[model samples]
Target chain A: MGIKRDISHTVWSVRGNAVMDVVTRSLEPLIAALRAAGYTVVGPTVKDRAIRLTEISSAAELPDGTGDVQEPGNYRLTERDDGMVFGYAASPDSAKRFTQPPRQTLIRSRGQVIEEVEPEAPRIALLGLRACDLAAIAVQDRVFLGGRHPDPAYRRRREALFLIAVNCAVPGGTCFCVSMGTGPKATAGFDLALTELAAPHRFLIETGSERGARIVAAIPHQAATGDDVAAADEVSRTAAGRMGRTVDTEGVQEWLPAAHDHPRWDDVASRCLACTNCTMACPTCFCSTVEDVTDLSGDVAERSERWDSCFTLDFSEVGGSPVRGSQRGRYRQWLTHKFATWYDQFGTSGCVGCGRCITWCPTGIDVTEELSAIRYGTEGPSCIR
Target chain B: MDARQTGRRPRLAVWKFASCDGCQLTLLDCEDELLSIAAEMEIAYFLEASSAPGPGPYDLSLVEGSITTPEDAERIRHVRRVSRRLVTIGACATAGGIQALRDFADVREFTSVVYARPEYIATLERSTPISANVPVDFELRGCPIDKRQLLEVITAFLADRRPVVPGHSVCVECKARGNVCVLVAHGTPCLGPVTQAGCGALCPAYNRGCYGCFGPAETTNSGALNAKLRALGMSDPDLVRVYRTFNATEEPFRRASEEAEGDA
Candidate 1:
């Protein structure tokens, strides 16, 4: 597939104009150009104590020189010494909300008249997407777009997206993309990838797609040199080094099934509030339930689809009973599926190794820790290797 | 007969066992989907939806809940005999549900906690999966199975092809949604790493941790997650409590709980 090609060495650097600096300066021009080209620019901006992807008319609206410090049940913003743009990672709100909104009108029916809701094509220029976010998008592509019954709305929106991926200059406390092999650098799946060079006000721009090439050509920037490439490489390496967490996925698929009868589930389940923040914060979760609403007249109604969590009792309602009645059953179902059985179904590990679940969980239940307990018996130390 | 080609409705029956009856409700919760599903299949026996139950050699039997009683065990045998194809739905039927918590504790003690007359309660020592006693054609994952996937399974079963329910972790769903890394963002405990991929990664999206409503994935390294939990400050008792949740009687969770209990 054209989607999976490696663009690791496709480095096209612009001299004197570091990618981040140029991105900051050219925000207005980029937005203007995209708008003129029939694209709506949406990127991360400070909102409700977190950086969220919202409509941006210019670069000034972006979160500049601000990064978030994340810990269990804690998230705070700190000012950066350097006035750098696109310095932070993904926000609490995932790009999935744009592609697969929390709630969507599927269809409307009135008496014998029936009409299907057609989603208007949205040409989106998503700015400052992290490599993990890009990997997440790829995962979603396999889910909604690659399935037998492709989600028309998701497919249309995805096809119209203009992605601007950025290599992480500074990793957050919870980031573990290095272990997941999803981030620190924008390896692929972007129209354009930007690497921020420190000293100079220039950017190292590399085009991953033809669309990226055109965008780079239109933007005002100088050609990048070997030094610029080295600077970008250093920035990526630093980001990778800063990751506070790691999960060894080596033979992970084989490991989970073998540990099926292991004794670690109970320990974790005890503290799990079953609030399901992890799934909500995850970048690749796509499970949802449909709802129908009718007016007082009871003649007109609309069917809507909304995001749902597996932690809830209603998520697995079958006959009149819940399959997983106890919190333990629910937790077991989730863990086993993520590590072991997913390979049987998707032919790929379901996890992209984003640490959203670890950070957002109210109880600080680390999946990596739980796996270690199961792999290395209870009497031993925490880390297996 | 080709149900799709000949327009002949496939006979469908819904069954239940020892559970909270939440999983079965997923079918009813599929309100709009249910109407369409009904149009495609003949509701041979669904006591929950209709009081008028029909006797049948059902083409497909969707069994929910779990067998926690001797009678239930015997009844499942009859159900398996009558149904051409039997699919276990929900965590209870596929993997003993919350009621299976009794498996660890004394049933008499449990009866004393809730019921006034311990003698009136007729229950088994442990709640077991349907597969333990009868052959199951398919086992849909989830505390309550994902309704969209549930519908897909039914559609595929009718179509006579393997259903495409991905057996990955909740983490996969989380990533696909582009959700911020919760573990990284909050350092909160979560089951997304080892949890199955269903419910569309809802808990994490809602700013909460995964509780593992879906059962174990194709392969799970729960031990690794347990070590992570300990490093995060979870006690052995805490670990035991975590495993003794819904589907606690399931082999993987059961073993994990026992280990935690042993340490405790």
Candidate 2:
């Protein structure tokens, strides 16, 4: 199922099929319809003082009336006066954590006989996904599925996914989805896209697929007028305009490759804690290592795939030496890979501008500011020296 | 066949000097992998887990703790001679552990502080890492080395290859877990950016700053971080205390602490 563009409430599929816009008073029926379709409804919920994307059974499970105040390394939940459903921006974790768990068992063996495990990808209806994350999922799809030997597990999970994209009503302090040209609006890669129009307390729904259309038709809904759809479009556009940061992606393709010798890298390394926090918080950064495990008896053994980061010296360990031995080298490697070399390999920029890397960086080391420093030769702070 | 019904298995031994025995406990914590490793190798000697001590000239030696006494200093040399590959495990064996904080103070004062008869308590003034006394082939870092990493080192020994261990900063792990930066957001003093990656950025996951249990990253930029900390309202004493924790004796942290003290 896919979503196509139209300022009007008409949504289209890949085959040029269109579905009319429908108005729903509350998000309660949508949740019920998704669950009734044998889908595990997963969305954002306030838990442990953070908006966590988890299994939600009803609208009450979502962070209703709650909004997030997010900045570089800061987040606080505030009560919204509007009581909007999609009040907050994206969480620290996108949809990647579930798709790629920190640890995943690959092979279970007894003695030398390796056994194949059963693949069970449940029907997961991902709700409240932002446009940047949609772009991230597309990138992950390319990395995990477009390869010669597709990760069978990731593929299984992808094939069973039912995407429900949400138009971001409010942009976070660190959001740069507008600069990335990825978000504020759910343009594509969704079976259904929603826009919350407050005050009237109604939702403008666009069914992007036949399944989405059927589901929308089943739920109690009224035909949306042109004004309602236009208001929905305005919400996403305003969110884009509200973004505080931007990455000059156009010049990064050229400047980053030539930036290997830039003194700015040394400057960044000085401030950089070399903590792997940025990569872990990133939605598209997919590096991993394998671990072997055996029971106490030594009879049963298993090899598990664990998430890894480039910050580790061993990530580049060879001949008892790490190629990127210095923080400068490592930081340069990471930023270059994300902005420059990724295009050389993937034909697209690696970062989605989700701003998780910025918000979660412990040091508040803004990637946008760092990239600008390297790009424009205005290395902001030489505080270390 | 040793124990696994295969060809001659590799010999493994465990040794301790001056430590909390935490790293030794980590080796035992490899409950699942321990049996598998035992099958592939001969558990020649591990005094904590087994009393059946094996002779030297062993294939792999996993040494824990630091050299505190003259006997420990001398005994490690013998261990180095017997073992083909000696891998130091944890902060004690790699960076002199928390006990190395005493290296900055008078050893006699410490002895007097603990012992009733000061003459009876014997220890070297400086509690040094295994590598300081003898050449170590590898160092598996951590207060207690990560069990999976320890397993990987052992497996690497058997396989005749270098273990894939990242010496990158703990920031990498924190990012990988998608946690918010405590330093930037809450102004929590974090050593993650300069500390070597291990323990999966655990402290930040629970909303606390890293204690640098894995030691400093390769060529740590504590200078920049110190400047940042000053901006965060961290007093000079707090900065000094930050650096003088578990792995205080490590070069980068030691240098940073000294600089902070100087500033104070």
CA lDDT of B171 in candidate 2?
74
Q: What does DockQ give for each predicted structure? A: 0.06, 0.37
B103-204, model 1: which lDDT tens digit per residue?
A: 777988988899989889888888889999999999987888898878877877775766656565676577556555455455556777666777888887
How would you encode candidate 2's per-residue C-alpha lDDT over A1-385 as one tens digit per residue? 3233221222346322356778899888999998998899999888756787889999999888889887766667789878798888878768887677776788899888989876557889999898888888888877786657778798777757777888888988888887787887887777788899976889888777667787888799998898898899899878888886777777877878887899888787777766677788788999998766555445576777877778766678789788888888888999999988988877778998888888876557888888878776574532111
Chain A TM-score values, per prediction: 0.89, 0.92
For candidate 2, what's the TM-score of chain A, rounded to 2 decimals? 0.92
- Per-candidate Cα lDDT values, in order, are 0.73, 0.81
* Number of the predicted model whose lDDT against the real structure is largest: 2
**What DockQ would candidate 2 receive versus the native complex?**
0.37
How high is each candidate's TM-score?
A: 0.60, 0.85
Determine the C-alpha RMSD for candidate 1 after optimal superposition of all C-alphas: 11.2
